[model samples]
Target: MPSLRVLNHAFRAWRRNRAWAKHEPETPFLADLLSGAPTCLHVGASDGRHSYVMTQVAPKAVIYAFEPSAFAFEVLKLGIAWHRMGKQVTAIHAAVADKPGELMLVTPKKSSGRMGRAYAYVAETKPNGPARPDLEDTGMETQMTPVVTLDAFCADHAIDRVDFIRMDIEGAEQRALEGAALILDRDHPHVLLEIHPPMLQARFGGSGEAVVDLFLKRGYRMFALDGVRLEERTTLVADLPWKDYFFIHPSRAARLPDGVFKARMAA
Candidate 1:
């Protein structure tokens, strides 16, 4: 029965994808968006790999890359300095959230002496449940980190206009957006974000569509990153129960690459 159940899921996912597929010059979908923008905020910057890529593509753009993990921030800084991107990319050692305060971050337990460092996520309060085995692997531990909202950060820094934002801070997209209401309304920047269906299901009693809805309500359209262009999705499909989404505000939609709608979406 278990084997049959496994087969059943594979078949369903296969059937669902009867037609379709889902990086970069490091990240292709973002090239156009960043080309015209002078300032970009890269939330969940990890070790600054993508931040570096962005700078390479848009050398003049100032990238404010944020990574909450101390372990990760060190690496992020090293990448920026090693590449001599110190002048273009600023590595911020903090988390972007809906509010400015301390929040608990869950990461793999180091005491286990495991060879791999677990992917860390902001541990949400209550009902959301703990991180999954694959994410927290070998168990999880908590470390407190300071978090700030995009709005507050922008205001405090006297940044009047923001053009692009790439945020993928685990499952905290919704909460982070809650705190970014000011930026979204004022800056109207283009965004690239990762939506974890499991994270929504486990933490928000919702699905990936809910995440889409959140952006839609904010006057953004969802698109899957397709090579050098943006492919708008009338129906949201999750390739691996998780994927990144490009949220183009109406103001920026006019700048999307041509040939984006060439192929029809599989019905």
Candidate 2:
């Protein structure tokens, strides 16, 4: 077995790369959320890498990460146990879908590491057509597994509210939200969502704006769009095409202090 120091270093490296970008150009929205040390719910947290960050920043808060992939769930559980944070962190072996039950979890045969249903959209829109390509060439496979909606899971677990939510469920954001209407209506947590426009349009017949509209109608405000566009330092795209967006409830906007806001502006 690897030494404890070695394991810690390895876990840190994995989080730095696979988790949210630590050095990415900061935005007021993210700084605001991180500064508050809020309780969070992470949807489709494949291996709970980002969940680690949440716990680090908010040691007193609770985090529930929902993941369906067996391999990913196993590793995530190991990471949580290794850190002795089994109490602060809760890992669920379920995917966020239209309902609480089983569904297909498609992944590349060779690289189950990058498994996600969002990839299904890419598969469906492949230029050649809709057919399972060679595993080596495509690096994915379509497998079935049980999925559950966040709302149902929360209800079953007796979770009353969430302060923040991070969703990266491939292209299943809309469905997840549809099932989480109660949480959105009652708890009003800040949400950080990754919306793949092409995938949303191709697979779900929905536009990215529709997802944004869902939150907007529920009294949430778009705070920032973080990712490639900021790093590239170019004006070509003008708007972020492929990236993560952060949204927060307007009522809680005052929780973000001026110092945090200034730090992000400097970044």
Candidate maximizing lDDT: 1
lDDT of each: 0.67, 0.64
Position 120, candidate 2: lDDT: 40
Which candidate's TM-score is highest?
Answer: 1
Candidate 1's displacement at residue 217, Å, is 2.1
- Can you write out model 1's per-residue Cα lDDT over 40-130, one digit (the tens) per residue? 8989987565676677667888889988887667666656655678888988888887778888787654435542322567765412333
Off by over 4 Å in 2: 1-31, 34-37, 109-139, 226-241, 257-267
TM-score of 2: 0.74
